[model samples]
Target: MASTRPLLLLVLCSLALADAHFKVFNLRGSSLSSSILGHADAYVKVFCGSATLGETSVRNNNPNPWWEEEFTHFKAQQNDVLRLEVHDSDFGFDDFLGVCQRQIKLGTNSHDCFLEKGGTLHYTYTLG
Candidate 1:
């Protein structure tokens, strides 16, 4: 029937434009800003647009930290912007170290984002 044909076409189109899987891994930071007390207790928050994908655990008393953690988003779209924010955690208030944003791309990608205060954030991502 004509109605059935249109429904089938819509389903096919939806499948063709289905969301992608995005993976973030191999996160590290070097020469980060130091806290007022001493070395920074750093952590990273990953986001896909306004939605939070994941966050790394805080590394205490470390200006340079490497996180052996991975985060994934199963419903990511190619047009989505991936945002990363680095913070230094404190007992009273967390300090904002820096932030980076990248447009989603197919395949594997890497970036070394420099923070606003100081330091470099190294990270890798894969989209499929």
Candidate 2:
């Protein structure tokens, strides 16, 4: 007699290999505390793998700026590394502020990662 176990295993494996949706709700603390006196024109760049997925608008000359911008990517995979880079827009060349990366997973969550500089960027992420 033939068994259905092998077919079931294949179906389960396919389900487990499905891609996930990743969403960035908002980001805070994009600017350094030392910039309290001088404002920073900050924006965020998001990268997954070799592709640059999303970015936020520049919060002009504002330290402790809040970006309530939302980003949704359908190609996000489990255990994928997501990187966020902050930059200061200038006339000629943009200055690098900071960057952080974290592993992607299922379900709704939040994370605070340290930037290359002595600054902190607070952001919330959800994987569905």
Best by lDDT: 1
How well does candidate 2 score on lDDT at residue 101?
86
Error of 1 at 85 (Å): 0.7
* CA lDDT for candidate 1: 0.90
Q: Which portions of model 1 miss their true places by more than 4 Å?
A: 1-17
**Candidate models: Cα lDDT each:** 0.90, 0.78
Model 1 CA lDDT for position 92: 83
Highest-TM-score candidate: 1
Score candidate 1 by TM-score against the native: 0.86
lDDT of 1 by residue, 25-119 (tens): 99999999986688889999999866898899999999889998899988888878999999999888899999999998888999999999899
lDDT of 2 at 3: 100
- Give lDDT tens digits, candidate 2, residues 1-128: 99999999999987766876778877887445344436767888988655677788888877777887887787778788888898876678777888888888888878887777656789888887
Provide C-alpha RMSD values for all models, in order. Answer: 3.2, 2.9
In candidate 2, list every pair of residues with a backbone clash. none
